[model samples]
Target: MRLALAALVLLLAGPTPSQFAPAQAPAQLRRGLASAEAAIRAAACDAERRFGEGDPDANASRCEGVRGPPGVEVGRTSARLRNPRNAPPGWAKAYLAQTDGKKASEVEPAVFDLGDRVGLLRPIEIRKRCLSCHADRAEVAESTRAWLEAAYPRDQSFGYALGDLRGFWWAEAAK
Candidate 1:
């Protein structure tokens, strides 16, 4: 009985090596990417919907107030993301160049080592409703246009149609 008791204690002492190791690298990466992507979209969509693509304060809040989902730092590739720090990695630029509007949301979340750390980029696109605010200068509401001009002096996040590439949501994770 003592031996059995000791054995039970030993078994419960700590986690197993396999448990410590956890899932394999690829699986972990996939899971991480999926979670990160979901988080990013949730935040971005909330901001976008709330702002209605016109309110300077709303947009600024998303850009400046919210850094991103935990470790992830999300922004647009153009003046949209706007911050140099939020710039997409080199690989993402290349991948984005090849990604079409239809494929933007569907593109496989790419893993990239941006030297500082590993990150995942999930592409995002402009939906039809988004074009109301993101469309050509002529199409945008006068009030929205004025707000955009006043807020973003060098704004380039315009002239997009439905299904256009607005930008991407990038999540930076520790290496």
Candidate 2:
């Protein structure tokens, strides 16, 4: 009975730090982040190309097809969000705050030890290809803009120029 009660107490206390594996090496985390970012960029560009080809359904389908490395969860976030679901979590917001005034290339991947997991965040730069969906409101294709309004009613992720800091690509993995 005592053992059962003790186990219940421990379980209720929640996970302890010692239960988690050590954080992945910074280099390994960076490599994984880079791979995820590349996949995302490729998907976004492909989506843009397909949209240009007059495929109305191609606006976000290609980007939605992107997948991260095994055991890693990846996402994108921006201060100006198109999807409210992409809002940065507390840790990411803290990291982003430190990146003000710096170009994407000038910023490095940020690594955080998250007790049971590790997180990495890398800035994503706006490229020419990204303008189809993310440029000034007037510059985007009318069809694309219509799709954007229908899909994301409150979208605010436009008005970016080439080379601007668009947002961050973040990855989280077990420690």
Candidate 3:
């Protein structure tokens, strides 16, 4: 009878360990990427509030972000999770590639189900803000353009229309 009961439990539980090794890597990466994107958006909003629209000062500022609730910065980018870590390597590389010298950009978070690991989502470009620093010669402010030329001699991250995808966050995690 005991053996029968055990067999029944196993049947009800569905797949056995040999059948399916739980995959949590994707989920984790998703969660992390989402949190990071939220942080970037919030930071951009905060900068706008603190300075003003089209204010060059906001470009150089970086706020310490919290990953989960209550704003913890351990590894997560928000004030939520207690154990957030830096974005995966691939995510970072992808994000940088998309930056292209735009005004502001944000990346989404990604997660894998294999090992509950986290990764970075794609980055959303700040279309309007680029005008202030990367606009055409007639549109961009003289001072800002001068600054760009002096600082980034080979800057090619300018002249984009609205609603264009600038960059995306990429990541890979252990499974």
Cα-based TM-score, every candidate: 0.57, 0.61, 0.42
Query: Which pairs in model 1 have colliding backbones?
Result: 76-81
Candidates in order have lDDT scores of 0.58, 0.68, 0.43
Specify the poorest-scoring 10-residue window by lDDT in model 1: 15-24
- Residues 69-152 of candidate 2 have per-residue lDDT tens digits of 576676778777899999886657755666644567777666665655666666788877789999999999999999999999
Model 1 per-residue lDDT tens digits across residues 125-170: 6787777678988999999889878877667667787766677776
Q: TM-score for model 1?
A: 0.57
Which one wins on lDDT? 2
Q: Which parts of model 2 are misplaced by more than 4 Å? A: 1-69, 100-102
Higher-scoring candidate on lDDT, 2 or 3 = 2
Instruction: Assess the local accuracy of residue 68 in candidate 2 as a C-alpha lDDT between 0 and 100.
Output: 46
| Index of the highest-TM-score prediction | 2
